[model samples]
Target: MTGLRPAPARVVLRGRTVVPGVVTGEVLVSPETISGWGGIDPATGTITEARHPLAGVCFTGRILVFPGAKGSSGWSGFFQTTRLLGTAPIGMVFAVTTTKVALGAVVTRVPALADLDDDPVAVLRTGDRIRLDATAGVVELLARTEEEP
Candidate 1:
């Protein structure tokens, strides 16, 4: 048998930068909106809202891909706590840009991108390995999950 293996599928997406930085991590997608104020436990980095699709999921270190933030302006504060607690997302790619999310991304101090040429929430799936270059406004797909095929 041949020793060579096929290269992983790759895709590059362009978007507007929210918080400029670079990061590489696995994607954790939330198809629905996330409310940081009453929706997540910053200490654990887990979505605590019962009805949320990503509820009970811990986003620490993952690149959070979601529609956008919901609820009150306090959302940013809660997200900042995650960063302080050392459990913040390594990056963020969202379809929508709200004050809450924009502020949260800034305070979280992670690579963040928004208004992608493609719908990030639809194109990016959980377990996808990506290099988020927010400064360059690029999201490079590095690998896909084994379960995807």
Candidate 2:
């Protein structure tokens, strides 16, 4: 009922929603390798590590799709800062559930889907538009039809 269409590469992830909202945005997939401390910049919303492939990139207004949270427990605090900075992502999809990410999502108050059975990393690509229905616990993909002016 949420107008979700079968994506070209379909995958399903099921989890609890820590935050509540309807969100749709580009997918930024990171496998189970995102380090909490260096993966994101709370102040600027830019990924700041040179070693990371996604360095210097911004997650503002995007759907951050990741397998799980890794490294520091300080992860939640960063999201809190980003929220204060007003540069947080629209939503998040996690293949596995973690308390760290859960707390972050709760604090940030952003729509988050987790505990997915399928690997969103494998099926979802960066820049792919994602439609997340938090109310129904469903995620759908719609083709990115270029930037709208």
Candidate 3:
């Protein structure tokens, strides 16, 4: 017997550009907001906030998908440290846009988009592959996470 593979699911989303760049990476969805000042460890690129869903999770290299930023104005500085430490996320997608997140995106110097047509936190799942084009304000879902049979 022969079997055929199904085509990969693809979804395109439009959003406001927060940064101008393009990058493709696995999605890391954080339903809640993230704190940059004391919520993350810049050196390790890991979330250090206790009780958070993604506590102890490292966002390095992945495309971080979340609502928005929280905590102090030092948010941008913490993310900047990640960039300096070479542990920053390859891309970022935000559901909400604020001055703090905008500044962080600018300093992180990564492809980032915000205010999408749909809530990315609801649409994207961890492990899904996506291509982010912040310059064009588009997010293309390249592939979905495979389900165990």
Candidate 4:
């Protein structure tokens, strides 16, 4: 069917460093504003935001791409819980890093990236293979094509 075509043949992104590390993994994208406080279940890594596009989605072991984190100073606490629960994202790519999200990234102890040459959140899609180099502030992405299953 015409609607089933794949996209993102191949692409690379650059961004500012947050946590400073390198990692490669599948990505989970959040098209809606994410709140670290009530948005995710730390133990399961599931997005709990009712109206969020990625609701009920688990980002564990993936590169999480989101515009930014919103609401409550408790953001970092929840993310830290993710780390302790072993359900944390391997890496994070944020469009804008606010204090709360920044702290979350730091406490989550995962490689984090932001302020890219182009917004990684928009350029990347869910299920894409990504290599996040937070130390070097770069992301190497392989966009999927319709040819691949």
lDDT of 4 by residue, 6-67 (tens): 33355777778999999977877787768988788998989998888888889889889889
Q: Candidate 1 at 111: error in angstroms?
A: 0.7
TM-score of each: 0.92, 0.82, 0.92, 0.89
Weakest 10 consecutive residues of candidate 4 by summed lDDT: 1-10
- What is the lDDT of every predicted structure here? 0.88, 0.73, 0.90, 0.83
Cα shift from native, residue 103, model 3 (Å): 0.1
Output the TM-score of candidate 3: 0.92
- For residues 1-149, could you state the per-residue lDDT of candidate 3 as single tens digits? 12223326558899999999999888889989999998999999999999799999999999999999999999999999999999999999999889999999999999999999999999888877789999999999877776421
- In model 1, pairs of residues that clash are none
User: Which consecutive 10 residues in model 1 have the weakest lDDT in total?
Assistant: 1-10
Candidate 2 residue spans exceeding 4 A from truth:
1-15, 144-149
TM-score of 4: 0.89
Q: After superposition on all CA atoms, what RMSD does each candidate show versus the true structure?
A: 3.9, 5.2, 4.1, 3.7
lDDT of 4: 0.83
Question: What lDDT is reached at residue 33 by model 3?
Answer: 98
